[model samples]
Target: GTYPLYDITASPLTSGTHKFDGPEKNNPYRVLGIDEKQNYARFRFSGERNKRKLNVEFLGIKGEKLGEWSISENDLKTPKQ
Candidate 1:
Protein backbone atom coordinates (compact mmCIF):
# COMPACT_ATOMS: atom_id res chain seq x y z
CA GLY A 1 0.00 0.00 0.00
CA THR A 2 2.94 2.28 -0.80
CA TYR A 3 4.67 3.85 -3.77
CA PRO A 4 6.82 1.85 -6.20
CA LEU A 5 4.38 -0.95 -5.57
CA TYR A 6 1.22 1.03 -6.19
CA ASP A 7 1.48 3.19 -9.32
CA ILE A 8 -0.79 6.02 -8.22
CA THR A 9 -0.41 9.69 -7.53
CA ALA A 10 -0.57 10.90 -3.97
CA SER A 11 -2.81 13.90 -3.47
CA PRO A 12 -1.51 16.36 -0.96
CA LEU A 13 -3.87 18.35 1.23
CA THR A 14 -4.14 20.96 -1.52
CA SER A 15 -6.39 21.66 -4.50
CA GLY A 16 -9.18 20.32 -2.28
CA THR A 17 -7.98 16.77 -2.85
CA HIS A 18 -7.74 14.76 0.37
CA LYS A 19 -6.71 11.32 -0.72
CA PHE A 20 -4.92 9.32 -3.36
CA ASP A 21 -7.05 8.80 -6.40
CA GLY A 22 -6.63 6.13 -9.06
CA PRO A 23 -7.07 2.44 -9.55
CA GLU A 24 -4.55 0.21 -7.74
CA LYS A 25 -2.35 -1.34 -10.40
CA ASN A 26 0.11 -3.60 -8.71
CA ASN A 27 0.21 -7.33 -8.18
CA PRO A 28 0.93 -8.47 -4.66
CA TYR A 29 3.64 -11.10 -4.38
CA ARG A 30 1.53 -14.19 -4.86
CA VAL A 31 1.67 -17.56 -3.18
CA LEU A 32 0.16 -20.80 -4.38
CA GLY A 33 0.60 -22.97 -7.43
CA ILE A 34 4.19 -22.53 -6.50
CA ASP A 35 5.78 -25.97 -6.60
CA GLU A 36 4.96 -29.19 -8.36
CA LYS A 37 2.18 -31.50 -7.17
CA GLN A 38 0.58 -28.21 -6.27
CA ASN A 39 -0.37 -30.37 -3.26
CA TYR A 40 -3.25 -27.95 -2.91
CA ALA A 41 -5.11 -28.02 -6.15
CA ARG A 42 -2.83 -27.71 -9.14
CA PHE A 43 -3.33 -24.71 -11.42
CA ARG A 44 -5.98 -23.46 -9.04
CA PHE A 45 -5.66 -20.16 -7.25
CA SER A 46 -5.68 -21.96 -3.93
CA GLY A 47 -4.65 -18.80 -2.19
CA GLU A 48 -2.15 -15.95 -2.05
CA ARG A 49 -0.32 -16.81 1.12
CA ASN A 50 3.39 -16.04 0.87
CA LYS A 51 4.68 -12.53 0.41
CA ARG A 52 7.21 -12.98 -2.36
CA LYS A 53 7.59 -12.68 -6.07
CA LEU A 54 6.29 -15.89 -7.53
CA ASN A 55 4.76 -17.27 -10.72
CA VAL A 56 1.14 -18.35 -11.02
CA GLU A 57 -1.02 -20.09 -13.56
CA PHE A 58 -4.78 -20.08 -13.93
CA LEU A 59 -6.88 -23.10 -14.66
CA GLY A 60 -10.16 -23.77 -16.38
CA ILE A 61 -13.15 -25.56 -14.94
CA LYS A 62 -11.94 -28.85 -16.35
CA GLY A 63 -8.52 -28.28 -14.78
CA GLU A 64 -6.79 -27.01 -17.90
CA LYS A 65 -4.08 -24.40 -17.86
CA LEU A 66 -5.40 -21.09 -19.04
CA GLY A 67 -2.57 -18.64 -18.61
CA GLU A 68 0.45 -17.74 -16.56
CA TRP A 69 1.31 -14.69 -14.48
CA SER A 70 4.02 -13.33 -12.25
CA ILE A 71 3.00 -11.57 -9.09
CA SER A 72 5.36 -8.98 -7.68
CA GLU A 73 5.28 -5.66 -5.91
CA ASN A 74 6.28 -2.90 -8.33
CA ASP A 75 4.97 0.02 -10.32
CA LEU A 76 3.32 -2.19 -12.88
CA LYS A 77 -0.08 -3.30 -14.03
CA THR A 78 -1.63 -5.86 -11.70
CA PRO A 79 -2.56 -8.20 -14.50
CA LYS A 80 -6.32 -8.68 -14.05
CA GLN A 81 -6.63 -12.25 -15.20
Candidate 2:
Protein backbone atom coordinates (compact mmCIF):
# COMPACT_ATOMS: atom_id res chain seq x y z
CA GLY A 1 0.00 0.00 0.00
CA THR A 2 1.04 3.67 -0.45
CA TYR A 3 2.32 5.60 2.56
CA PRO A 4 2.92 9.22 3.49
CA LEU A 5 6.27 10.85 2.75
CA TYR A 6 8.19 12.47 5.58
CA ASP A 7 11.61 14.11 5.70
CA ILE A 8 13.01 11.32 7.82
CA THR A 9 16.49 12.47 6.82
CA ALA A 10 16.37 14.61 9.96
CA SER A 11 15.18 11.77 12.21
CA PRO A 12 13.84 8.24 12.23
CA LEU A 13 10.19 7.50 11.62
CA THR A 14 8.28 7.90 14.87
CA SER A 15 4.65 7.76 15.93
CA GLY A 16 3.48 11.33 16.15
CA THR A 17 1.88 14.19 14.31
CA HIS A 18 4.10 15.49 11.51
CA LYS A 19 3.99 17.07 8.05
CA PHE A 20 4.18 14.75 5.00
CA ASP A 21 3.85 15.66 1.36
CA GLY A 22 5.49 15.70 -2.05
CA PRO A 23 9.01 16.98 -2.38
CA GLU A 24 8.17 18.21 -5.84
CA LYS A 25 5.78 17.40 -8.69
CA ASN A 26 6.54 14.43 -11.00
CA ASN A 27 8.05 12.63 -8.10
CA PRO A 28 5.88 9.48 -7.55
CA TYR A 29 4.08 9.93 -4.20
CA ARG A 30 2.42 12.54 -2.00
CA VAL A 31 1.33 13.32 1.56
CA LEU A 32 -1.78 15.28 2.29
CA GLY A 33 -2.71 17.70 5.06
CA ILE A 34 -0.45 19.51 7.51
CA ASP A 35 -2.88 19.40 10.42
CA GLU A 36 -1.58 16.02 11.51
CA LYS A 37 -2.31 14.62 14.97
CA GLN A 38 -2.42 10.90 14.32
CA ASN A 39 0.62 8.67 14.41
CA TYR A 40 0.83 8.33 10.64
CA ALA A 41 0.22 11.01 7.97
CA ARG A 42 -1.73 10.44 4.74
CA PHE A 43 -0.15 11.10 1.32
CA ARG A 44 -0.80 10.63 -2.38
CA PHE A 45 0.19 11.99 -5.79
CA SER A 46 -2.95 13.64 -7.22
CA GLY A 47 -1.52 17.19 -7.53
CA GLU A 48 -1.10 18.40 -3.96
CA ARG A 49 2.23 19.94 -3.15
CA ASN A 50 5.88 19.92 -4.13
CA LYS A 51 7.93 16.76 -4.40
CA ARG A 52 9.56 15.48 -1.18
CA LYS A 53 11.94 12.73 -0.17
CA LEU A 54 10.05 9.65 1.08
CA ASN A 55 12.95 7.58 2.26
CA VAL A 56 11.17 6.83 5.49
CA GLU A 57 9.33 4.01 7.21
CA PHE A 58 5.73 3.43 6.22
CA LEU A 59 3.86 3.22 9.50
CA GLY A 60 0.82 1.03 9.72
CA ILE A 61 -2.52 1.71 11.39
CA LYS A 62 -1.15 0.39 14.67
CA GLY A 63 1.87 2.66 14.48
CA GLU A 64 3.93 -0.19 13.13
CA LYS A 65 5.94 0.19 9.96
CA LEU A 66 4.56 -1.85 7.10
CA GLY A 67 7.55 -1.14 4.89
CA GLU A 68 9.69 1.63 3.38
CA TRP A 69 9.95 3.48 0.08
CA SER A 70 12.54 5.76 -1.52
CA ILE A 71 10.22 7.58 -3.89
CA SER A 72 9.07 11.18 -4.30
CA GLU A 73 5.63 12.65 -3.64
CA ASN A 74 5.27 13.96 -7.15
CA ASP A 75 4.00 10.80 -8.79
CA LEU A 76 0.71 12.50 -9.56
CA LYS A 77 -0.47 15.98 -10.51
CA THR A 78 -4.02 16.09 -9.19
CA PRO A 79 -6.01 15.60 -6.03
CA LYS A 80 -7.72 12.21 -5.50
CA GLN A 81 -10.70 13.91 -3.98
Candidate 3:
Protein backbone atom coordinates (compact mmCIF):
# COMPACT_ATOMS: atom_id res chain seq x y z
CA GLY A 1 0.00 0.00 0.00
CA THR A 2 1.00 3.66 -0.52
CA TYR A 3 0.62 6.48 1.96
CA PRO A 4 1.37 10.19 1.96
CA LEU A 5 4.54 11.70 3.43
CA TYR A 6 4.54 14.48 5.97
CA ASP A 7 7.13 16.30 8.09
CA ILE A 8 6.38 16.01 11.79
CA THR A 9 9.08 18.44 12.93
CA ALA A 10 8.34 21.68 11.09
CA SER A 11 4.95 22.00 12.72
CA PRO A 12 3.93 23.06 16.22
CA LEU A 13 3.28 19.41 17.06
CA THR A 14 6.99 18.76 17.16
CA SER A 15 10.22 20.73 17.66
CA GLY A 16 12.83 18.36 16.27
CA THR A 17 13.50 16.07 13.37
CA HIS A 18 11.64 12.71 13.31
CA LYS A 19 12.85 9.91 11.11
CA PHE A 20 11.67 6.34 10.81
CA ASP A 21 14.82 4.47 11.72
CA GLY A 22 13.29 1.02 11.41
CA PRO A 23 12.62 -1.21 8.47
CA GLU A 24 10.84 0.52 5.62
CA LYS A 25 8.73 -2.54 4.90
CA ASN A 26 7.16 -2.50 8.31
CA ASN A 27 3.99 -0.46 8.60
CA PRO A 28 4.38 0.90 12.12
CA TYR A 29 1.69 3.50 11.64
CA ARG A 30 -1.96 2.60 12.15
CA VAL A 31 -4.63 4.53 10.30
CA LEU A 32 -6.48 6.30 13.05
CA GLY A 33 -8.95 8.37 11.08
CA ILE A 34 -9.44 10.76 8.16
CA ASP A 35 -10.65 14.28 7.37
CA GLU A 36 -12.54 14.77 4.15
CA LYS A 37 -12.92 18.51 4.40
CA GLN A 38 -9.16 19.00 4.60
CA ASN A 39 -8.17 16.04 2.42
CA TYR A 40 -5.78 14.77 5.04
CA ALA A 41 -5.06 11.35 6.48
CA ARG A 42 -4.52 10.86 10.19
CA PHE A 43 -2.03 8.35 11.47
CA ARG A 44 -1.13 7.33 15.01
CA PHE A 45 2.50 6.85 15.81
CA SER A 46 3.71 3.96 17.87
CA GLY A 47 3.90 4.77 21.60
CA GLU A 48 2.34 8.19 21.02
CA ARG A 49 -0.89 9.77 22.06
CA ASN A 50 -3.94 8.20 20.47
CA LYS A 51 -5.60 11.57 20.07
CA ARG A 52 -2.64 13.35 18.60
CA LYS A 53 -3.56 13.74 14.96
CA LEU A 54 -0.90 13.96 12.25
CA ASN A 55 -2.56 15.30 9.14
CA VAL A 56 -0.72 14.58 5.90
CA GLU A 57 -1.26 14.46 2.15
CA PHE A 58 -0.44 11.96 -0.55
CA LEU A 59 2.84 13.33 -1.94
CA GLY A 60 3.70 10.23 -3.91
CA ILE A 61 4.81 6.94 -2.41
CA LYS A 62 7.88 4.78 -1.95
CA GLY A 63 9.45 2.23 0.36
CA GLU A 64 11.40 4.92 2.20
CA LYS A 65 10.81 8.05 4.19
CA LEU A 66 9.62 10.60 1.68
CA GLY A 67 11.06 13.68 3.35
CA GLU A 68 11.12 15.88 6.42
CA TRP A 69 7.78 17.50 7.31
CA SER A 70 6.07 18.66 10.50
CA ILE A 71 2.35 19.30 10.86
CA SER A 72 1.21 22.14 13.07
CA GLU A 73 -1.40 21.75 15.76
CA ASN A 74 -3.60 24.11 13.83
CA ASP A 75 -3.42 21.94 10.73
CA LEU A 76 -4.38 18.83 12.68
CA LYS A 77 -7.12 20.47 14.66
CA THR A 78 -10.63 20.42 13.30
CA PRO A 79 -13.26 23.08 13.85
CA LYS A 80 -15.73 20.66 15.44
CA GLN A 81 -16.41 17.00 15.81
TM-score, one value per model: 0.27, 0.22, 0.19
Per-residue lDDT over 1-81 for candidate 2, one digit per residue giving the tens place of the 0 to 100 score: 454434432223354656555554334533422224343433433333575544545554567655454555555234455
lDDT of each: 0.35, 0.45, 0.35
Error of 2 at 62 (Å): 1.3
Among residues 3 or more apart in sequence or in different chains, the pairs in candidate 3 whose N, CA or C atoms overlap within 3 Å are 7-69, 7-70, 8-69, 8-70, 9-70
Note the residue pairs that clash in candidate 1: none
Steric overlap count per candidate: 0, 20, 5
lDDT score, candidate 3, position 47: 30
Best by lDDT: 2
Segments in model 1 whose C-alpha atoms lie over 4 Å from true places: 1-51, 73-81
lDDT (10s digit) by residue, model 3, range 36-60 = 2122223434334544444443221
Candidate 3 at residue 81, lDDT? 50
How far off is residue 63 in model 3, in Å? 1.0
Preferred candidate (lDDT higher): 2 or 3? 2
Model 1 C-alpha lDDT versus the unseen true structure: 0.35
Sort the predicted structures by TM-score, highest score first. 1, 2, 3
Tens-place lDDT per residue, model 1, 1-81, is 223352222222222422222432222532222222111122223334443454555444455664565545432444554
